[model samples]
Target: MDKKLLEVLACPVSHGQLFFHSQTNELFCPASGLAYPIDAGIPVLLEAQARPLTEEEKQA
Candidate 1:
C-alpha cells in the first residue's frame, strides 16, 4: 500500500485513523472496531463492506 494514500484514508464510519495490517492485508480502525479490506491494492472504505473486529483483534 502507498504511504501517501494510507495517510489520507480514514474509516468511512468513524472517520478515524486507519492502521494498515499487513498480516491480514486490511486497514483497521481502532476507534471504530472495524476492518476494511483492500482488494487489488484498493481500499474498500465503505462502512457496509467493513467487518467488525474480533475480541482478540481489539486486544491486540
Candidate 2:
C-alpha cells in the first residue's frame, strides 16, 4: 500500500485512524473495533464491508 494513500485514509464509519495489517491485508480501526478488507491493493472502506475485530485481534 502507498504510504501517502494510507496516511489520508480513515475509517468511513468513525473517521478514525487506520492501522494496516499486512498479514490479513486489512485496515484496522482501533477506535471502531472494525477491520476493513483490502482487495487487489484497494481498500474497501465501506462500513458494510468491514468485519468486527476479534477480542484477540483487539489486544494485538
Candidate 3:
C-alpha cells in the first residue's frame, strides 16, 4: 500500500485508522473489528465486503 493512500484511508464503519495486513492483503479496522479486502491494489471498502476478524486475528 502507498504510504500516502494508507495515511488517508479510514474504516468505512468506524472511520478509524486502518492497519494493513500484508499477508492477507487486507486493511484491518481495530475499532470496527472488520477487515476490508484489497483486490488488485485497490481497497474494497464496502461494509458487505468486510470480514469480521477472528480472536486470533484481533490479537495479532
The model with the greatest lDDT is: 3
Among all windows of ten consecutive residues in candidate 1, which has the lowest summed lDDT?
Answer: 6-15
lDDT of 1 by residue, 1-60 (tens): 899998998888889899999999999998999999999999999889999999999889
**lDDT comparing candidate 2 with the true structure:** 0.93
In candidate 3, position 44 carries an lDDT of 97
The RMSD of every model to the true structure, in order and in angstroms, is 0.8, 0.7, 0.7
Of 1 and 2, the candidate ahead on TM-score is 2
Instruction: Report how far residue 41 has shifted in candidate 3, in Å.
Output: 0.4
> How does each model score on lDDT?
0.93, 0.93, 0.94
- Give residue 8's lDDT in candidate 1 (0 to 100): 93
What order do you get sorting by lDDT, best first? Answer: 3, 2, 1
Clashes of 1: 0
* Candidate 2 local lDDT, 1-60, one digit each (tens): 888999999998889999999899999998899999998999999999999999999999
TM-score of 1: 0.92
